[model samples]
Target: IQQKEHPKFKRKGDDLFVEHTLSITEALCGFQFILTHLDNRQLLVKSQPGEVVKPDSFKAINDEGMPMYQRPIMRGKLYIHFTVDFPDSLSLDQSKALEAVLPPKMTAQISEMELD
Candidate 1:
């Protein structure tokens, strides 16, 4: 039987992939959300403390994908692809705060000829 396309999930064999968008703050800090599975199950998805999810990163939930053929109890993996949504612009105070908390910026020296 062919699988129907889901609004939030893409299936390849038994594996499922879903894209989740997170705010910039959520990516750097922590985030939690409920994911509705194909079986209509509500899964609580969250990031660990101090665990930063970079853009285009992926996380997986074991045995949470489609049920394996001939094995209804067994399932494949569910992958969550994370996308970070950054603000178009940051306020001066916000920028300063980020700079203070993040790693120090690297300085580079350029000659005047390089500017030309």
Candidate 2:
């Protein structure tokens, strides 16, 4: 039987793939959102407290995909592909604040030129 195309999900061998976009703040901080399944069920999706989701990262949900063929009770995996959106520019104060909270910047060393 041919499966109908879902607006937010792509099916591949019973597995479901969905792309989710997040802001820079949400990528660094934690985030929570609801996802609607094929059966019109709402799923609460969230990141761990210390979990930092990078760009193009994937999160898999067990048994949340399309039902297995023949075995109606069993299901595949639901994968969420995440993409982070960054701001166009940051002010000097914002940069300094981020620098203070984030890791220290690496300094490049310059060697003195020898006299010709």
Candidate 3:
């Protein structure tokens, strides 16, 4: 974490000015998705793993068995960062499966995994 000093402000006269400066440090954590457009395009579709996928890859099936091949823009390194609020019941095999899909260099940091 890095500490940054920012100026505090107060509005008094017509001219706005900083009354004082305060130092603060903020901590932020979240998942990051790095996707590459399969078609070599700049547009990227980002979402968490197991989240609602884009409309293209999956098709809504009706009782009549109507199949629609909605090609979603696929391609890119999807990085998912898990927080402390993440579930603790995940198994090692499941985690390994996810790591396999990632690029050779990309790896997930699993902080805790204990078998009973």
Candidate 3's displacement at residue 108, Å, is 14
Error of 3 at 34 (Å): 26
- lDDT per residue for candidate 1 within 1-116, as digits (tens), equals 76677788998888999999999989999999999888799999999999999999999999998899899999999999999999999999999999999999999999999999
Point out the higher-scoring one by lDDT: 1 or 2: 1
- TM-score-based ranking: 1, 2, 3
Q: Weakest 10 consecutive residues, lDDT, candidate 1?
A: 1-10
Tell me the lDDT of model 3 at 52.
Answer: 35
Write one digit per residue (lDDT tens) for candidate 3, span 79-108.
Answer: 222222334565999778756865577466
- Total backbone collisions for each predicted model: 0, 0, 5
What TM-score would you give candidate 2 relative to the actual structure? 0.90
Q: Please say which candidate is ahead in lDDT: 1 or 3.
A: 1
Task: Please report, in order, the local distance difference test score of every candidate based on alpha carbons.
Answer: 0.94, 0.93, 0.30
In the order shown, what is each candidate's alpha-carbon RMSD?
A: 1.6, 2.3, 22.2
Q: What range of 10 consecutive residues in model 2 has the weakest lDDT sum?
A: 107-116
Q: Which stretches of candidate 1 lie over 4 Å from their true place?
A: 111-116
Candidate 2's displacement at residue 37, Å, is 1.2
Could you estimate the TM-score for every candidate? 0.91, 0.90, 0.18
